[model samples]
Structures are given as structure tokens and as C-alpha cells.
Target: MASSTTRPDVETAAPSARVAGRLLDSSAKLSYDPLTEVDWETPLDTDFHGASPEWSTLYGTSYWDELTEAQRKELTRHEAASVASTGIWFEMILQQLILRDVYAKDPGDDAVQWALTEIADECRHSIMFARGAKKLGAPAYRPRRVAVELGRAFKTLAFGEAAYAAILVAEEVLDVMQRDWMRDERVVPFVRTINNIHVVEESRHMKFARDETRKNLAKAGPVRRHIHAFVIAVAAYVIVTSMVNKGVYANAGLDPERALAAARSNEHHKAMMRSSCSGLMDFLASARLLTKPALAFYKRAHLI
Candidate 1:
């Protein structure tokens, strides 16, 4: 009977649903448990960097040039922890958005099931990031009050293409850096493992988000499209700005004001961000989400 059943809905399902089916299969084969995969028992190795030095915010700045090798390593470690902390913040927002989207949807649908699976993966990631930060000997780092409140509101209210595109932006920004860190020998082994796990899992999330974004945009009128395009850009700016917390500078034994200024204007970091996000910008343009209003924030964030 099951074999005889002709499901017209499956035949008519959007491309997004088809992609979700493939992702479900891929995940069943290659998903990770960060808790068991990461080496948690090893003590923090001061000799190793938490992330690749080239990914550092102040990597090529004058101040960074003056810092001793030990200070440089220490700063990178704190920066890495701050990034992880910021990631947890965004992951919470994303989980809520996905859960809201899937609420009351058919539980048996492959797309809905994949969404639930992504949420579970994020839950594991948040725990993994928390433990990783603790083991790095860094305190909890968070975004500014304004950013946190804005994120809360966005997660609660954003829907359709707006929500999925914003999710794609955050994941894309993190994915580029993680790819570099995962392969670099200078990075701590456990951190590399964490990055590797995140990279593999998030590839699925990004693919799903991209598909959903395009699918949702198909239903949007010009007015709605422009509004959500701007919203996604603002969200991008917030997420990118929050990647490394200001408190990390002081905690890393640098002058907070000077370090913050340097990082804000760091040419190397800006170039890195731009280079890494070029493909994402192309995707956004292809989706016609790169309205003039959105371009301003993209330029400001150096993600264009």
C-alpha cells in the first residue's frame, strides 16, 4: 500500500524540500556529537593559539606588531573565546526562529524534520562552545545591551526570507573563519576539532537556509522584498559587529579603548571579511535581495 500510494504533495514540493531530503540523508551519515568528539580533558596549552593568527582582528595592525609573541597568542585566545560566545548568542536566536517557522507544520515532512534536526545540532553546538570557552580560560563574552535586545526582537518577529537570509549571513561569516582555523596547525587541536564539526554541520544549515530564502522570496511583492532586504542587512551588520566583544581587549591585558579602535579600523580584518563574504554577496545579488538600502549596511560591515 505504501509503495502504491502516489503522494502528489511530494511531486509538487518546492526545491527547498527536495534539498532538505538530501540533507537529512547526509546528516544521518555524517552528523557529529561535539561532546564525544572533542578532547575535553586536555589542559589548555599556552603554547598553542586558539585560532589561526591570520584570522585575528588586529593581526596586521601596528599595535599587534608591537605586542610580544606571548601577548599575541594570548590576545588570539581571548578573541577566539569571544567569537565562540557570540556564536552561542546567534545560535540561540536562530533556534528560536527555526522553531517558530516549523510550529504546527507536518511533523513527518522531511523539511520540518530537518529543521528540528538543525535545532538539535545548534543546541549541541551551544553547549560545545560554552565548554570550549571555559576550557580556554576566558570569561563569558557577550554583545552590547542594544545588540542583544535587537537580536531578541528579530528572533521573535522575523519570518520567511528575512529570517532565513539573516541565518545564512551569520553562518557564512562564521564558516569562512572556521574553515581556516580547522586546517591551521598553529591552532589548538581541540579547537580545530570543534571548528571542523561546526563547519561540517553548518554546511547543511546554510544550504537549507539558502533554499528557503529563495523559496520565500518567490511569494514576496516588491514592497515586502525591499523591507526584508533592508532588515537582513541590518541583521548582518549587527551579527558581524558583535563577532568579537570589546571586553576581550581588556581581558587580554590590552587597553580596551586602543584595542577597540584598532580593531574597528583594522584594514586586514576588513579585507578578510570582504574576501570571505564575496560569494555570499553574489548569492544575495542573485536572489535580488541586494537592494540599494541593503548595500549600505553591507559596505559598512565590509561584507560586500
Candidate 2:
């Protein structure tokens, strides 16, 4: 009787174990040490934009048109730094969530091992972002006070699908933008290198998050699904809004009041977000996490 039960348990765990094993192998084959991979010694080049100009928050605004080429480059550099800072914040949250998730689990399990591996990646990523921001000559751009408090609560209390789904949302959103910037010749070399590293490593993390989300949701009831859906949506909203800090405008020598107003109503920026995030929205819909309430939040965030 004991052998029969144990056999069934092992069979049920096979798929995720295989996925985790593959991820481990992939990391071993092609992982980056950002400290070495990035050109940290090179001074910031003012001639190149920090990101693709099309990904800028004020890209199509009248204010954008009015800026000189140098001003536009400055703005984009600050914007990119702000985005990297926000990535650090979200990565920290996900790291805590993952650690709490695997706590006391079987150390030998491939999934738990993979979880630890991912945490290590995030630790390196946070340090990389901090150094990159300093190189760009930007101040530490933290999320708003409300967002900080909310993230603290969510990271502490969220579990299973809520935690994994939220992690997926943040990764997916950043993935789209980074993919563009990494390939654009107009972007600075070092920043492009940073994006390339992030894009490669985060692909694996996104895959794990997607698999864990579906696995966890399969065990959830309708009520729990609905609750988690809303929680994940709120988390997405906060993450999206916090990406480019308002302080970036001032740092870039733009009038904060005018830049903020223009950015808030930038139709081009909204369209870019919606188009870029279509794949993520489809994944959420397929997983049945795109409930009406969730859709509303996504729309408000311009991610739908």
C-alpha cells in the first residue's frame, strides 16, 4: 500500500520536475554574471539613448517633439534608470515570495532547487540594476509610498497562484520592452547588454512562473480563483504605474509638472503598452485569470 501511494505521488510530480531540470541545465549552459558581462567601466555615452526612443513614456507627446535631441537622450537615460530601479523592487518582492513558498519543502526536489536558483539570479539582478542606475547618474528611484506599503503586504501574505501570477505579470511586462531595447542600435551599448542578459535569463523565470501558476490554479476552487485574480490584477497595476518614476522627469532637466501631465495622457504610450502586452493578456485569459475585475485593472493600467 505504501509503495503504491508513493509511486502515484512521484508520477504526479514528474512534469514539473522535468521542467525544473531543464531550466537548471539551461542556466548552467548560459547564465550571465552581470558584473562581468556588462561594460561597467565604460563611461555613460550621451550620444546614445538609454532605451529605444519608441519605448519612452513621453515619446509622442508635444513635449517630446519640442525637446532637442540631447534633451530626448537625457530623458530616456533617466527613464531607463527608473525602470531598472523598479525592476529591483519587484525582483525583491518575488524573491521573498518564492523563498516563503519553498520553505521546508524537500531540498532535493528539482522544483525547490530551481526556486533557489531563481532567487540567486534575482539577487544578482538587483545588484546589477543598482550599479547600472548609478552609472546612468540617476538617483535611487523608489516606488510611491502607497505602492511600497502595498507590495510589503502582498509579498508577505500572497501564496500559490496569486504569488506566481503576479510574478509572471511583472516579468512579462518588462520582457516586451527589454526585447525591443536590446535589439535597437540607438540604445547605449552597456544598457543593451544589460537588457540582453535580462531577456535571456528572465525567459526561464517566466516559464517557471507560468507553469507554477497553472499548477496551483488547477487546485483552486472558483472562489479562490476569483480572489487571486483580483489580487494579481492589483499587483499588476501597481507594478506598471511604478515603472518610470516621476522624479525621472526632473532628473532629466524637464519640468516635472509638464512632463507628468503629458505622460499621463500619452496615447502613443498607451497603445504601445496594449500592443506589447497582448501575449501576456492572452496567457492570462487562457488561464482564466482574466476575470472582469482583472480585465478592468489591466485596462486601467493600459496593459490590455
Task: Give stretches of model 2 more than 4 Å off.
Answer: 1-13
lDDT of each: 0.92, 0.93
Clashing pairs in 1: none
Indicate which candidate wins on lDDT: 2
C-alpha-based local distance difference test score of model 1? 0.92
lDDT of 2 at 75: 92
Model 2 residue 20 CA deviation (Å) reads: 0.6
TM-score (C-alpha) between model 1 and the true structure: 0.95
Candidate 2: residue pairs that collide: none
Residue 103 Cα positional deviation in candidate 2, in Å, after optimal superposition = 0.2
lDDT tens digits by residue: candidate 1, 1-304: 0133334465467676778877777787788888789999999898889889998998899989988888888888999999999999999999999999999999999899999999999999999999999988899999999999999999999999999999999999999999999999998899999999999999999999999998999999999999999999999999999989888888889988998899988999999999999989999999999999999999999997
